[model samples]
Target chain A: MFRNIFVLFAASLFCFASCKKTTPLEFQPGDKGELEVEFDNVIGGVNLQLNTGSYTNASGETFKVSLLNYYISNIKLQNADGTTYTVPRDSSYFLIKEENPSQLITLRDIPAGNYTGISFVLGVDSLKSTAPVAERTGALDPAAAGAGMYWSWNSGYIFLKMEGPSDVATSGDKKFRYHIGGFGGFSTPMFNNIKQISLTAPGTSMAEVRKGKAEAPHIHIMADASKVMNGPMNISIATNTTVMVSPFSVNIANNYVSMFSIDHIHND
Target chain B: MINKKKSIRARLGITIAVIVALVSLGVACTKTSRQERKPMPLVLPSNFPAPIYNLSSNPITVEGFELGRKLFYDTKLSRDGTISCGSCHIQGSAFTHHGHDVSHGIEDRLGVRNSPPIMNLAWSQFFFWDGGVFNLDLQPIAPIENPVEMDEHIPNVIEKLKSDAQYPGLFYKAFGEGDITSSKMLMALSQFMLQCVSAESKYDKVVRKEGAVFSAEEQLGFDVFKAKCASCHSSDLFTDNKFHNNGLVPSMVNDSGRYRITLDPKDFYLFKTPSLRNIMKTAPYMHDGRFLNIDAVLDHYDHGVQVNSTLDTSLNKNGVVGIKLTVADRANLKAFLNTLTDDSFIRNPQLAEQ
Candidate 1:
């Protein structure tokens, strides 16, 4: 009886189907991507200028930037191939300031491949501005070391406010403080767009990056802070710096900040 | 022999059919259960636009909504566990701070902006009165992380939620993971907040013709509102979500309402017109909560409007006071605004208490 039962089971098994193929995950893991961004706070491409920024004519006060701080979120490094590596929404970006160069942003877990270029916003878009309280390191620090681009009263970020001082304002010289916000539609505050750059022979692979593929790929951005007051007001307000309280940046003229370059990411 | 073979084959066929049917039924039951376990069984009014917050990226589950409510009431959500969202946004007072113009938070901390009422917010395009914060999902972070409010960091709040055993279970039920994070925290809070729709108000019933009718005073006030304030504060949704410089110039500091956020000169003194669903309950109108009551707000619009270039075009009347109403008309409009107060919404057991 036992032999018969075994024989029957064996015969059934032979009649049954073969093994099913193992499936792969919807999200496949790829090689790692490395990136480096550099920034040059310079004056007319001559001096490696720091501690200088522009002012807005909203208050007509000249405020030479003593500090510059901003955020760059949703970073992406595009490979030469069709495939692109995007910085995850939850992590892999920075809110960097000029004061802290040692703690630059480095994105990992990227779909590592041969990459040519990178792109990122100078400030968080309005959508991300809604939840600006996500905590991380470096740019995520509440202390905001090296970055002076946040408003103390409003608690909102100055996405592209370049302030230092201007000789144009009336009532003697005044401190130019341009607070730029507005990420949500027309009235939101959180937008500063920097140009995008593509790195050449830029290998994101840790091994290739270590083996000297290219100067750690970074985009260079130069914002001339001196041009903050080159235009009309962004909002209605008193011209005197000591006079206006909640003034806003309205227009951009010769005094507006510029991206300068698109491909050369400033790493330092 | 033929009959025997036929019965054997028939039995095998019946067995296979039963097994397949049972298996499929199990899967179907599970799929139905999953559907039932969704966050909320509601959506915004049809007239509204697409929600700024995407639900797919951060899905809402019934568990998530419950957890959010628990967190909302829990004192632990605050820095010192002494103050919670309920401290300022009390259901009894219609979610706005009743006594103070500006909100008082942790350690008797004072917020610069008035603690605006929180209700029917799923339809709101902007969060703050100035429309600074865009999405509803991001609104809690302002209160939770503000130095004068919760005085806590996102990391610290996540840590606190992670340590709490109750929260872990609640979180697992809601999000399928016990490891608490700020995103999860924010998502959960949003689920709870979004479901805070005040559609069951008497005003809503009247609109639906559900045997609800306005009194003579309310009817007169309604007529007045349509005649005078209907341009900016439009039909159905109270506000058209447009901003206006209602001719208010602060004697103290020149605060350029929406202009502060956009840096645009045209939007000065313009604010996100607040929903008047519970306007009667939400006192101290405007961004700074300067006015004491709805009566004062009416008075401002009636006799005190100052004309300027950036003023809301809806209110301008060629140097004439925009939408001037008699003292009687103002009182009647105030009554109509009062009718918008949803007592049931404020007293709903599903939304209130710990």
Candidate 2:
């Protein structure tokens, strides 16, 4: 039954995708309705593979992972119509890897329209963050989103967290963690990071991701692999290779990368 | 004359029709104004009408409630401290500060509000007498951070708990993860609080019509209570959970009850209707702990209500406002109120400090 439902869903999604554009492109198009976004991770030009690692925690010892999945909400693409095609508040947006389809998510019925740029909040909106728990479920349910991100004991979510092998950690062995969330209190902005990008509208006036564009889709996403690490450069050198592995960070707060910003193209 | 009479009749008919239409429109508008209250789940008893604090986001969790209970009693949760929630809210006095009106904490600092007896808490939409704290999980933070209370931050509390010999194991059993977190801690406290269900009381037994009968004195008190107080302090649950000017001198120092929460003048001197289930044990009554016993309380209520507009209507059924009680009647009323003392829930060792 599950497989049948999956197949049916996949077929419908294909129809939804095809109906939006005349031809298929390597990447999705602007406001491609219900497009399955496969987050195939890469560093520079090579694939990024991560694995579980063991280290001591406050509890003495445990095996954790090199990467963890979380949810991001309030997604929007700035369209030339001056409309924001926000991911419907009722729908979901998750950061599940392509390799983990069972765990990954597919956002459906995304409002079809032309969009200049895409933006999203990195964590669940604050109002929903502090809400109560009703049921308990397994590893990959929306119920688990709260389990992964929320801290009931304190009454907020860990809006941003990056923990991994780091030489610059308080301890010599290379695992460091920074959980940034204080609900935007006097000093803490609930979380440490907010990522934004700028881009030109993808279509003429019609709304849809088109076929065979010479350029990549103008979904302005800003990420700096360099911002996450703090250690001797790629100590493992394989999992950490290609991905920047530096000791400090340079995010938009420290530096900015204007995605699809025309200034990078015409001035030269 | 015939034409004038016809015109008058026509005008009357039009006025009634317009009034009917307006009333229907008003009802529709008012009904739609509030957000759609979610339908109660099957777990909600058939007889119960609807829940007040709509559980829209905070869904009920069987596991989370259990987790909250484990954390409630575990002293390993405190930092540099030998205290757990059970240290203060003991079972005997109905989950209140045992033998004391004010709560004592790590290093012996005193908390302000009389440790209100906890019971039938799920029925209540608000916590604390002042009704300042809206959420139950948020309740622990007041004590944990108050310099006189536990005086611990959530992160430190979790850190301390994570290292404790038994806590990580307990946490893993409750939550899948061995890592203890503040959110997890709050969930666990809620579990214990929900478990502290006082549904099997004599009152409950009576209300459920389960062959429980009242003594003559108790019956008389119940009658007087119903006649005078039950309108505001509605039965089934001992309170309507509404704030009222129960009529004490506004405390010289304390916040003006619900007014402190809303800062509205209309709510001045209003306080949450104190649940009377274990009122006999949780003494030093009133928000500021002004009255010492039921005598003082009844006497105060008998003749003590501040004659302000916000004084709840039940107290002034005849529109003759002000606490009204004859001395003999006061004694009878107190005699009746005493029947609400619940012994089983009070003495349940499972809810005690380990």
Candidate 3:
């Protein structure tokens, strides 16, 4: 009986070892998968339709967004097992436009895991903002991809740009322009509006990135446009129509910090 | 056995020596290849402080500087192809828009401020009167994009260069086989501007004891200048490179100067200190070009300083609003200021637009 029990135990150990080798529940070191973070720009729970959608702010001013663009960079994902995966900084920067259909940031070669949380910077970091011009290619290219999103005079990228027409706007064209950017000054300390955003999947709806999966999990993130004028401080269009590099821009930046939230995760 | 051991040791020594010789030969070959592209030397005057610009990042090369010169003189950079960087910044006027109180850009669009001289820019930490641009590599974009200035988009300029018959080849020679990128273009422009060193003035000669001596009156003027102006125009570069409110009244546009850039209340009406080097050639003086001549500037310092919340403390020493000047002091000071004129720098054929 003792011999039989020992044999069974030895056989079980071998089986366990083989099973661990072949059908491991956790991803191997070299295993990689893809993830898609979709930025859905919305205005007060409604899908934002650029140029036609009318939205009212907390200040009771109705407005229509003509254009909207913002930079999302330095993406990081946290695994359920406490391991963190950082997307390579070079491939991390994304400029999301309201008009662009490609709002889905497809993160390729991400280690297969159950990602529980996501974190990113809303604006270009100071280091990239001041990096040598050659390194600033792709979305960060000032003249080409970036275009009007850069402040040529100020020597920095305008992280978030929202322009629209409002009856209450004091500008002659009845347009309010908010060009928010300042990555702590290069030589001296200045207005730093780079906002860090972190969001966790809601209650067991974590993104399950698998190597052989038919489709990558899509993380739906809602960026509310109304938060620009309604967050923390109620910014009235009549009072401030054009806000660029100003002390008041800090308040606008503060309001927009709470704009992003993970609505759902599609692990199909 | 001892003879065999010695032979082995001799062979090892010869092997090591051969490897060292081969490595040195490879290094020499690389050095020869590097010397194929002649490096244009940046002027480092013995009297001046070390330059603020890092030369290692953008080494001045003959081809790159020539390309920059061509670009500087090219009107294609502007929207209408009528105005170039050289149009506003004339080399004869110490690279300033001479006699224009405020420079006019393409289609005679008047700019609000005076065209600051491009001389001694390598020493400058910030560009323009308001210190808006910190890096020299990023300065050209401002004028290129400003509606009143060149009024041309950078991408368009790059496109134009790519199609140009001569530009692509020139760019290739300068930056080596790459599409005409704005980064390479800007670096090339900097290579030319960095060589615009204005340290060959008579004052420099006198200081260096290069057989040039200040006259008695000029010496007296120097003493007065040392007492009154040298604090702001501190180094041999002739500028502290710091912004200050020199007490000029706000213009019709109500230009807030440094406050516009920093958005700090304390920085109100603060403008960068104009360098005293080639000060005679770069007039009318002041940020707005309100003073037409050196005497007007001196007169302003003597009586026209308007007190404000952010006026420079040096101007308000012991409640005296401005520097006091006597008749002899004015004459001698003028004589000393005149000695700062470096004719060779402004007239250098190498820096001229080809």
Best by DockQ: 3
Q: What lDDT does candidate 2 reach at residue B85?
A: 76
Error of 1 at B143 (Å): 2.0
Candidate lDDT (C-alpha), each: 0.61, 0.54, 0.89
Model 3: how far residue B140 lies from native, Å: 0.5
lDDT of 3 at A228: 91
lDDT of 1 by residue, A134-213 (tens): 34234543323313444333444556544444465343444445455434343443333332333343232211222222
Proportion of the native interface contacts kept in model 2: 0.02
Model 1 CA deviation exceeding 4 Å by range: A1-193, A197-268, B1-38, B43-59
Instruction: Write one digit per residue (lDDT tens) for candidate 3, span B39-67.
Output: 89797888878888878888888999999
Docking class of 1: incorrect
Return whichever of 1 and 2 wins on TM-score. Answer: 1
Measure candidate 2: CA RMSD.
22.3
Put the candidates in lDDT order, highest first.
3, 1, 2
Give the better candidate number (2 or 3) by DockQ: 3
Stretches of candidate 3 off by over 4 Å are: A1-26, A211-214, B1-36
Of the pair 1 and 2, which is ahead by DockQ? 1
Q: Over the stretch B274-300, how does candidate 1's per-residue lDDT look in tens digits?
A: 778788777877777889987778778
TM-score (0 to 1) of chain B for each candidate: 0.84, 0.78, 0.90
